[model samples]
Target: MVPDTGKTLCADTIRPVNLPEPVAVREDAAGRPLMVALGRRLPVAAIEDCWRVDDEWWRARALSRMYYDVILGSGRRVTVFKDLIDGKWYHQSY
Candidate 1:
């Protein structure tokens, strides 16, 4: 169950969403990741929630995803995802 803003999640109904696949990447000489990860951490109150979803179970190339609804330091809402099979991270926004 999802908890609305200012509302609490029901303890007995707590479900463990599958955490996104973890990935490791070194910073480029151009410092892109520094501009991507640290640059995208959320603010204190704006992040509404995180969601997880998986798809393509009927196909060989399924994608398992976990999305984070993050309010960036700049007040922009962004979504980040992790790819389970290849262990990589990605991001998007609406």
Candidate 2:
């Protein structure tokens, strides 16, 4: 469970939120995903961490994702994930 530190938190229940959003991304020459656009193009001030999850690969609808914890230019921190199976982006919050 995500700690509630005066910020939005994801509940323990596993719900379906399969919505995908289009975000403008800034990348290094090596093509690493850097800045992600929340509303406007914001530089990635810092990437707190990152991780990958691969699940249900045997099923027809599989789950594969790469999640990043980042602080935006405006200092708003958010957790964003890239859908590796479909190459899309999404933000998670309460």
List all candidate RMSDs to the true structure. 12.3, 7.9
lDDT of 2: 0.77
Tens digit per residue, CA lDDT, model 2, 1-94: 9667785546865566745556666666844457887778788888898898999989999999888788988898977777888877777664
- Model 2, runs deviating above 4 Å: 1-22, 29-31
Best by lDDT: 2
Give the number of the best model, judged by TM-score.
2
- Collision count for each candidate, in order: 0, 0
User: Candidates' lDDT values, in order?
Assistant: 0.54, 0.77
- Compute the lDDT of residue 40 as modeled in candidate 1: 35
TM-score of each: 0.49, 0.67
